[model samples]
Target: MPEYQRIHVSYNGRLGVPVGLFVAVDHLRRAGRLSPDDEALWLTVDDWFIANLPEPPQYSDGNTAGVVTWFKPPLPAAMQRRVEVATGLLSKYGVPWSISESDDPGEIVYEDDFQVAVVPPVRGEPSPMPAGVTLGPTTGGSKQSLGTDASAAARRHLAYYATELADRANRPASPDRQRQLAAFIAQCEALELATILEVGCGGGRDGVALQEAGFDYRGVDLTPEAIDICSEHGLAVTVASAADLPFEDDSFDALWTMSTLMHLDGDGFSRAVAEVGRVVRPGGLVAVGLWGSEPPRRRVDEHGRLFVRRSDSQVRQALSRIGSVETFETGQWYDDGEHYQYFTLRAT
Candidate 1:
């Protein structure tokens, strides 16, 4: 018989040592010294064992032959030497072992050459689409259907045109204007909300207005440059579309999307409205402001970027499927060569 060296193993805090024992076991099994069906495999490093070949059956009085329960102190040096010899012989035979603790080396829990598998956490299933909703085929495709101008120059040109459209539509608030708007939003919500979500927050002007009024606000915009401007001014904003917001459902108590849906037309607008409704909890207030016009109206603003112009009735019909609508059309008249309709619809 070949002489084998002995080693001691110990561990603390984690299961790293047990994994190591599994590795050592793999080597011993390969050398034919350790049988695949060995009963010792059932005993863990936390369990004590005698080194004799018959596995020294676990019971002390030798009456019973099951595995031992507790470990006792004052193990004989010869028994310890036998354990060291077993571990060392396994090691010399290129076997792998796993231990639970690092300080004492003889401890062995599991040993195997095969792969160890880990189970990942389970994720919840996606929510079902709402009633009366129709999703187009291209909605889930990996291609960009919109904003395809072919060339980089064309894309830049179109982007510039969009920016100009956004700018021409820009109506900055006077010093007292934002305060009144904030008050209006708070009144509509029926209470002071600590956190607010603003989708399609153009330029983040309204978001800033709300933040200044003491609400912790996060705004998201589709236009990257618009989001950049909002961030430049020290606002928490991100470039994200409203229809596919990067947030969990029902994450906010209040949502404010001001005059922002005019850009979305037809089914796109309807879907976005429904998505917003899904994200807001029951009885949560959503204040929507939009430019109103009769249906079948589409116009390119001064910058030549197209926008949908919907009447009050069309807007109501589109969103009513998701929540109750309370329309607020400001009677303030403006004739800047463009029809300006303001509404504040409350989502039930």
Candidate 2:
């Protein structure tokens, strides 16, 4: 019963609010129920908590159909203050609240250094993502292993780019992104590659580079806004998803998908990779860059988007099913032990 024993934190224990209070407030704002001033008021602590805590996969895209997250105790002073600020908002908003030492909430669907998301017993059904979710040195578990197709998960990702990342789309590639483009271009030239198709080519950043490098280039993205931005620069881009590209078989000599496939997993991932095989001729090149490295999980990021960080081994296993991996590289490990994974494969 030691694991179930309660440990009091800086406040008490009410990290669960059908979802986190933070997520609920976000929904409220979206629904036009919460005022901007009031919402901004609560965002002070909401920002801190999200920046400090681990987000449960169930709440990815702010969906909390099942699971409730509880704060893991022995709180840091700074984090404790933030939680208190959050609790204060709960009071101000007139959201009924409570504090309990009841450590046994229910089934532990997710856990980490910062919190645990559980299926409280009174809830009749299993969590939407009851398969389990965790990150950072913990055992990996998620809906991905069950082979559930989350093709729809990319909707939030597209919206994120259309709004929060619109400016980024319009800007030139970041220095690191520039490096990725350079590497991919090198691979293309080495392969005598031509007729490139860039998947998820937001604002055509990489498309422009590929064309300038003297390769015939075309691109596709699901976000209309991003397509518009790319089109403004006179880049040839069509709205499309990686899982379902509107192109002919063996349509290109090479393909590039950078920081895009990480948003998809399960069947969505499989289909996209399959599309890669379908579009590129045998012996053609495919380059992938993802800001992720872990056993695949549907964990939410600080931005509240579904970023399925997949393990290098799993990614290779999948990619190898369609091609032979010829190059492999990774960026410096992040604070949470994840990293940027990049690789090039020759289609079979």
Best-fitting candidate, scored by lDDT: 2
RMSD in order of candidates = 23.3, 19.0
What's the lDDT of the predicted structure labeled candidate 1? 0.49
Worst 10 residues of 2 by lDDT: 135-144
- Taking all chains together, each candidate's TM-score versus the true structure is 0.49, 0.54
Q: Cα lDDT for residue 300, model 1?
A: 58
lDDT of 1 by residue, 40-60 (tens): 221211122222222222323
- Return the lDDT, model 2, position 3: 36
Best by TM-score: 2
List candidate 2 stretches off by more than 4 Å: 1-155, 170-174, 302-304
The number of clashing residue pairs in model 2 is 1
Model 2 residue 239 CA deviation (Å) reads 0.9
Q: Distance from true position, residue 144, model 1, in Å?
A: 13
* RMSD from true fold, candidate 1: 23.3
